[model samples]
Target: MNNLATPGMLTAVWISLIVYMGVILYFVVRGARLTTNMADYATGTFQFSPAAIGLSLAAGMTSAATFIINPGFIAYYGISAFLSMAVFLPIGAIISLIVFSKRFRKIGSAVNAKTIAQWVGIRYNSASFRLYMAFLSILHLTFIVLIAVGLTQVLSRALNVDALPALSGIVIFTFGYMMFGGANSLVYTNMIQALLKVVVAVVLLFSGYQLFTNADAGFFQQLQQIDPKLTAAFNTDSPLYRDFFEVVICQLIVGVAIVCQPHIITRSLLLKDDKGMNRFLWVAVILLILFFTVVFTGLYARVLFPDLMVAGKPLPLDAVMSAYVTTYFSPVVSLFLVVGLLASGVATLESLIQSISTTITTDIIAAFAPNVIGKQQLFVNRLVIAVMAAVTIAMSYQQLVNPDLSVGILAQNGVYASFSAAFVPLLFGMFLKNVPVQAAFSASVAAVVAHFGIYYGRLTPYMETGTRNPGIAAALAILISLLVGAVVLVLYRQTKKEVAV
Candidate 1:
């Protein structure tokens, strides 16, 4: 299909785009005026209410990755992925609230940390750690930019616009505005965008159910029409079925990456205290459950359009929802999906960009140019955002060129997200009872090495199958980090004892 949109559909898309963009812009403006100082620019002056922080965290976690790829997850894995997400996400949020925020808030406040890398620098007294952390900071910035580019593609496809100019305009306009207002704009605007995401997700949910009109037939009937294996809970004979459980289990572990996620962690720094995080933990957990559960919409797509899924074959689950959206939903609804899509992509990208800028400005830039201030600092930040935008845009183009990179591949690229390796040790050192700095350093290095080794070694089942998931590898890597951290801690303690004697 050249473009799935009709002339009538295009008009509806335009109307939704104008209204949503305007609403987003208002929040951006409001956030800018409210930002009075550098503090306000980063961490909302440590004054984010539970509501704002909760929304930012939820929105950051649930990106277009959730909207686009998650449904595909459901289409691919049936009910199992959903089950794991339900069980796993709450564990992540509780850890974030009960374990992380209080400790992080104290450290962030004491050191006046602007970014995770800056936080690491303060916590560890290591310039090398800061350098590695900055690289990871830019790493996420690259991914978010790729997300932005993907959002551009989805938006262009749905709205019936040529993608090239659309992406160029989006990159320039959004990046500049984001650099101008800094994190001040990001938090409030993200809160607003995040709120809109709720509306959009709700719309997708009901509309999806609406599209799945045959409640009487439901899973079995749909399976009968398509391959019985489409909803097959498990069958030893089928490779896909046997592998699905392992894949979802891996997803659950990668869900732990939520712990190290800097964008979400940045929200922790914004909160007033642990109370702010604990107060809204359940709400955030619910939001994620809703987000993951909504992935079932892809199942609805698979069922409702049996022809789309071939007789013997399980359709390319990744493309099924986009196809369904074009055919099944109203033009207006698809537009809202696009809006949610845009919000999700931009939200993730914006948060990453902010984190990167914060690191560069607070750690690297400030280290080199301590006297930098006002418009100049802002200019430096803008330069960082522009570079990030350009690089990610390139990554996006590469993904498009490499048609082999599916939703799962792109989403799983998150295994490489810096939080797991760079921030994890520092945060663990602060929160864990007896973690030594030396241990933190070793864990930090070991996790990175282990992640790359397990992944590239072709040792994991995911590698044997040709599909890749960094989630399980990430979990192993983190565990390795902890184990190494512990050993290093013990050794350091013993050496100190001998020195004292």
Candidate 2:
């Protein structure tokens, strides 16, 4: 809330942002020139290297949450939060990404699928089901809002501007360029952003080097001196990392299903062919592991701001990282860090805008009004981005003003529910043949119902808190979806056998 940016820092940030915007526009123009139709916009005609696409994947998958937001959880809860967020979650997610990418790419490329919704609908051989999945994709707006808010938090502090104007500028600029660029520009820009992020990640990770070396009691001991809970494996004081179930099991489930999102999974389609798959996976996994470790910087922030205050004002969870960067670093170093933070959020925002707008245009609108599927589709997609921009601005403003601990909570709720529904369908569709559309549809519906039901209805002890863990809700929903799908499949098979007999 406090203005922490020096005049020099503010001037540097504005200049950097302007230069960054110009670079982005160059790519957008280049990519737009190649983007003739919806297919080209979705997958791109230009053949990109595996390493570039890998960087893009790592960038999109990490997002503002990993860089800007999740660290606040670590700042609040400590090693427990880090283990769940940085360690266990990534373990599940990396393995899932590795396992799912090849199969998903093979199927998606075969079907010429542009979005996850289309993949689901095509895999299930149901138009109505595809429409349903497309509509469900709107849940990703929550994530867009999360990134927008996170970016606003960083930019507002860096530019020494108010939140509203910062939020507006971010939404308009990112969405505007995204309307033109699609996958072509997205991959290239994300590659650059990922590289910047790698530098920033290293800087942030080592920022607390003095604390670790200078402390007589050592780092963990210093944390223990501050609060014994900070050094604990499971911080019972924290809602999210209170138990083994919450810390490990639920995160594992959510991590595996996290790839079900459109932006994350459809990334594989950017690859020209199967030969690049190994390089892509290796690059993505290694970079992502590094990005994930940036959350440890939150622990550093905690060490610095033990009371979590800047100039006597309490630091909001969302503002913690921004505050730390501006307060601790020199003006020039802070400028670089600020740009990296912006890149982290903007990278994902672009991917989300491209994927979600494509889904709405290609899968949802095209299904409802087949006439909108042709040359007019690109125009329609831009309109969709405009509408999304407006919605994101509105929602981001609300979250910026009034957050439930952090915007990450709201994002996780919507994002988790969406992927929870998609998980069973995508997994079954990919691995299990002869899967009935009815089974998939029923499972998706059940997952949605169970997720929201448990979350809002407060059916579990975890949900009883004001700030509930979306992971727990999503984990439950996934299990319920699997059970319901398996049951329906069994019944359908038995019915077929009886009829044959």
Candidate with maximal TM-score: 2
| Candidate 1 local lDDT, 269-289, one digit each (tens) | 776666665665655666766
**Candidate 2 global CA lDDT score:** 0.91
Candidate models: Cα lDDT each:
0.65, 0.91
What residue pairs are clashing in model 1?
A: none
RMSD of 1: 3.4
**lDDT of candidate model 1 versus the reference:** 0.65
By lDDT, the best candidate is: 2
TM for every model, in the order presented, reads 0.88, 0.98
413 Cα displacement, candidate 1 (Å): 2.9
In model 1, state the lDDT of residue 406: 56
The clash numbers for all candidates, in the given order, read: 0, 0
Candidate 2 Cα deviation (angstroms), residue 460: 1.0
